[model samples]
Target: LVVRLPLYIHLIHSHIHTFSFSYILGPMLSYFNFALVSASINIFFFIAFLFQPESPYYYLMRNDVDNASKALSWLLKADEDETDKELELMRKSVEEDRQKKAGWKDLVATPTDRKALLIRFLIGFVRQFCGIIPISCYSTQTLKAAGDSFIISPDNCTIIMGIMMVI
Candidate 1:
């Protein structure tokens, strides 16, 4: 989880720079580069995922025995036929999960789960309302519009924001 923070910081830092640079491009095509860059990255990731295999559990639930066996074999580093026991266990687990109705309904059904959901919902709610997203998205334009801080480039303002975010 600690390592996850750095990754998020890096991604948000990229967003800061991308939009900061957009301000330099002025209002006409302000977000063009950022959109292009973001889209290209997303397309690359999408294509990468296209090559990846579907989850074994998904195939098993669909009753695609052949594909489920193959996926299980790949996951367990064993031959497809060797996964019979694993598949049987997965079948049992899936049946149990279905019997328990362990889906979105369960997320808020019980007292403990409801509390967990409330805590998570509040955390996400606070995160967005705490100014991080807007700051990263428009801190450059905000600095530019402020007029008094005209000496520091919008790009530099983004760097300062990024540093503050990391710290």
Candidate 2:
């Protein structure tokens, strides 16, 4: 998990940059160019996913043993015998999960559990009323309105805000 910290950060950074650059381009480029650029990213990901194997669990859940075995073999890079053993283990795990039952009463089963649940609810309630989403959505327009008082352009300020989020 520690080794993947950079990967997580890179994912966040790329997403922020994508949104910031697209927003900046919307005003500067032709409407078609802006749309093409935005759509191209999604198209690339769609094509890439087309070649990837489906989740073995998806096939297993549908009782499709043959496809599940094939997917598991490809994903695990294992031979037939090893794949069969792993598949059996997976089947047992799924069966056990299906046998278990959960209910709303489980949320407050213990004092510690109840405390944690209450804290989570409070945090979510506070977050919803915090106005962060609204603020972020209107930030560019707000910056543009106050741009006359600043040295930098509103577009540059937007990029700065995106970088700050990445940090």
Candidate 3:
């Protein structure tokens, strides 16, 4: 797990970076360039996943507690007793989670849940159909229409947007 931490962080960073770039710089980039960048990121993620270590939680689920304990000790630099206790707590949490069977239909069955669900869905739908993409894609043309000459480079804009997201 320790060895795979960097890969996990990379995966998370790539996802947030991609979304930020899409949302903030999509219009500035040519569609072809955007596709190329997206493909490159995907390939990087594939390679990272290829070398990532398997989770100890998965091993425990398969009744391989000895191997799971060893993995935990390696990641935590802790004794076997401490690792066993930690793993036991995790097993309990998984059991509790499994006992709670909440589904989408249940959300809609309750009035309060249904209202919350609808509002969340509406927000997501509105965001997807917003004109931000078109505005960004034709940013130069839009500026020209306004008789302006200023241009916003996508890379700089994306970095700024990524910082905002992190904050």
TM-score of each: 0.61, 0.63, 0.62
> In candidate 2, what are the lDDT values of residues 7-96, reduced to their tens digit?
688776776766677556754667698789889988998999799887777777778889989988988787899899988977786677
lDDT of each: 0.71, 0.76, 0.69
Q: Write the per-residue lDDT of candidate 1 for residues 6-119, one digit (tens) a residue.
A: 679887687566545544443334377657866787899899979878777788778787897787777678764567888888878777877775567867888998899999
The Cα error of candidate 1 at residue 143, in Å, is 2.3
The regions of model 3 sitting more than 4 angstroms off are: 1-16, 19-34, 144-146, 149-167
Error of 1 at 84 (Å): 4.1
TM-score of candidate 1 on Cα atoms, chains taken together: 0.61
Sort by lDDT, best first: what order? 2, 1, 3
By TM-score, how accurate is candidate 2?
0.63
In candidate 1, stretches whose alpha carbon ends up further than 4 angstroms from where it belongs are 1-30, 75-77, 80-85, 103-105, 127-132, 145-154, 163-167
| Structure candidate 3, residue pairs in collision | 27-136, 27-137
* Higher-ranked by TM-score: 2 or 3: 2
Give the per-residue lDDT digits (tens) of candidate 3, residues 39-104. Answer: 988899899979755667777667687787777777777887888888787677657767788786
Better of 1 and 3 by TM-score: 3
